[model samples]
Structures are given as structure tokens and as C-alpha cells.
Target: MNNRFKAVLFGVLLVYGLMLSASFILALFVRFDWISTQSLDWLPFLISLTIMLLGGGLSGFRSSEKGWLSGVLVGVIYTVMIMLYQFLAHDVWLHDGQWLHFITFLLASISGGIIGVQLNQRND
Candidate 1:
């Protein structure tokens, strides 16, 4: 209910929403045969970065100095959600596609954390 908590929640929700959208769009493209669905994991990576930006921007707007943690937290949440969704939809684990999400999430978290930290310090 406080500003800090609100900002963190907002960032996580924003990233999760964007990541879901990206996954859905990727599914569409794959279904249409426009692109190889096998590479759909790329969607999460790119979208995660976008979400990181959103998270960083929100944290910056809130004038909070907790950018890196917020970004990393958001990334981790998004990754967990994505993995859950994948499991529910495919009912499978240990697939190539699954690994993509895992790897991308890891990278996104690091990059997003750094970005968030930098952004938090920008106006200081």
C-alpha cells in the first residue's frame, strides 16, 4: 500500500503482462507459419528487456533508489509465470522451448537489474 511496494508491484505486473502478450503473439506467428515456432523463446528475452525498461521507468518515476532489485524481481516473477504457463499449456517440461525461456529469463534479469540501478541513479 506504500509507494515503494506499489512501485515494485507495478513493475512486476507490467513485465508479466508484456511477457504474456509477447508469448501470445509469438504463438500466433508460429501458428501462421510465418516463423519457426521453435525460436519463440526469443519473444520472452526481448519482452523481458522491454518490461525491464518499464520497471526502471516506473521506479525512476517514483523517485526510488531501488531500481536494480525491482527490475530483477520483476524479471524473476515474469520468468516463473511464463514457465508455469508453458507447463500448463504443453503439459511438458525439459523441452528445447522451455530452456529458451529459462536462459532468456536469466539474461534478462541481469540486464534489467543493471538498467534499473542505472536509471534509479540518473536523476540523483
Candidate 2:
């Protein structure tokens, strides 16, 4: 397999893994009344930003060049996966504010990818 492809694959997987773990933990917290659901309204946004950034960073680190491209690929793939999931599971074709979220997430990932490249360069 190509190194770049491996990088993107791992990045996506890492994001999904983190999301699963986070969901489980949050579910536990909610189930046990450790946190109020009302107060966790920002949870999705936070998680999306954080996970995408991490994934983009990983992709950039592994690719070792063209960080922005890596970030864009990761963001697009992630968004497509999400759309597929919603369509298959919930029978939903579209959602409000999708573009806003996509743009924000993409920018966050791009920023992270650039940072990751800088870090890699510094280490080299």
C-alpha cells in the first residue's frame, strides 16, 4: 500500500475510534447522571472539531508533505462517510447547516495539518 493511502486510512480510523470511545463515555456519563444533557449541547461540535484536527494531524504527519491536501482528503472522506451513515441508518438525505459544519471542520483540519507539518519539519 502507498504510504499516503495508509496515512489517510489510519487517520480516518483514528477519528472513528475516538468518536466511538467518546460516545461510549458520554453515554455512561449521561446514564449515570454525571452530567446534564442540557449542558452538553456543545458536545457534538467539540468532538467533531477535536477529532478532525487529530485525524488531519495524523495524516499530515504520516504523509510528510502537502499537509493541506491531506487535510482536505480526510475532511471530505469523513463528511461523505457521515452522509452515508445518516442516509443508511436514519433515511435522512440532508440536514440543515451541513455546509457550515463542513466548512468549519475542513478549516480546523487544515489548520491542524499545517501545524503537524511544522512539527514534523521541526523534528527533522
Candidate 3:
């Protein structure tokens, strides 16, 4: 696959994987409300970092010009996935805290994409 395609796929899968894992962890610890973090706060940041580093490393097609687009794409895809899940599960719901979740996700995705592209260029 071309590097751009690989970069896009990596961004999508990395964000998806991290989000799902974070959701699972939240569900697992919902009863205790561990550290008062029942909301999905950490997921987006973590996913963005993972995707930025891993995706760039793997694809080796990083460019500052594409960072914004890539980041936005990842954020949009992740949000849509979350929305779909909320739709599918009748009991599942996003509280007001979810606003923070989406915001963080967008910020993290954008930052990560920028950093990734910068690193890729530097390395080259």
C-alpha cells in the first residue's frame, strides 16, 4: 500500500483500538469509579499519541502540510465511531462529560498529527 494510505489506515486503526480499549477499561472500573474518572477522558490523548508515533514510524510518509487534514480525519472518524456505539447500545449514553471527551480527542488528534509530521520531516 502507498504511504499515504498506510498513514490514514494507521491513524484510523490506532485511534479505534485505543478508544475501544479505553472504553473497556472504563466499563471494567465503572463500579469503583476509579480515580473519579468514569468518563472517557484519557482515551483520546492516548490514542493520538499512539497513532502519531506509530503511524508515522510505520508509514514514513509524514508531512506538515497533511497534518491538519490527517488529524481532523482521525478525530472525525473516532467521534463517528463513538456516536455509532452510543446509537447501538440502548443503555449506553454520553453524559455532559462527553463534551470534554470529544474536545480532548480533537485536540489530541491534531497535536499528535502535527508532532508526527514534524518528526517525520526532521528524520528525513
Candidate 4:
């Protein structure tokens, strides 16, 4: 595979790993009563932002052109992967308001890609 593809894959994996780690830590905290679910309701959004930003940035860094497009592709891939997993594992379907979150993820990713491309240009 090309370097850009490899970078996007790496970014996705990195995001997934970080998310898994975060989930484990959150579970531990909840089990120990160190945190409550109600208070941490925003965690998912935060995690999603991080995932898109990191993934998009990596993609943009490696992409030869159209960094925003690359970022959008990465975001879409990640969203589809997560949705598919949820469907397969829990039979869950997309509910109301979820689309907004998805849009936010896409926008965040695009912004990250822009920044990454600019940074790469600067470095060169």
C-alpha cells in the first residue's frame, strides 16, 4: 500500500487503541465509584474528536494532495467501522441526533487535515 494509505490505517488503529484504553480506564473508574456515568456523558464526543483529529492529521501529513478529502475519507471509514461493529455486536441502529455527531467528526477531521498539511508545508 501507499504511504498515505498506510498512514490513514495507522491513524485509525491508533485511535481505536486509545479508545479501548480509555474505555478500560473509565470502566475501572466507574467500578471503583471514582466517576459516574451521568457526569461523563460527554466522553464519547471527546474521544470522537480526538480520533478524527489524529487520524486526519496523519492522513494529511502523508497525502500528496487534497488533504481535506483524505481526512473526510478517513473520518467516513472510521464512522462506518464503528457503526458496523455496533450493529454486528449489539444489533444497534443509528438513532436520532447521531448524525450531528458524525458531522462534527467529519468537520473536525477536515480541520485537522488542513492543519497537518500546513504544518507539513512549513517543515518542508
What Cα-based lDDT does every candidate model obtain?
A: 0.63, 0.86, 0.63, 0.80
Against the correct fold, how does model 2 do in TM-score?
0.94
lDDT of 2 at 78: 87
Candidate 4's clash total is 0
Cα RMSD to the true fold for all candidates: 3.9, 1.1, 4.7, 1.6
Per-prediction TM-score to the true structure, in the order listed: 0.59, 0.94, 0.63, 0.88
Over the stretch 41-116, how does candidate 3's per-residue lDDT look in tens digits? Answer: 7654565556444443332335345776677666766777777789787657677787776776666677667777
User: Between the candidate structures 1 and 3, which one is better when assessed by TM-score?
Assistant: 3
Better of 2 and 3 by lDDT: 2
Decreasing lDDT order of the candidates? 2, 4, 1, 3
- What range of 10 consecutive residues in model 2 has the weakest lDDT sum? 108-117
lDDT of 3: 0.63
**Candidate 4 segments whose C-alpha is farther than 4 A from its true place:** none
* Residue pair clashes in candidate 1: none
Model 3 superposed RMSD (Cα): 4.7
Cα lDDT of model 2 by residue, 7-114, tens digit: 788888888898889899999999999998998988878998999999999988888888888888888888888889989999997789887898888887887677
Preferred candidate (lDDT higher): 3 or 4: 4
Better of 2 and 4 by lDDT: 2
Better of 1 and 4 by lDDT: 4
**How many angstroms is residue 4 displaced in model 1 relative to the true structure, after the best TM-score fit?**
1.7
Worst 10 residues of 1 by lDDT: 55-64
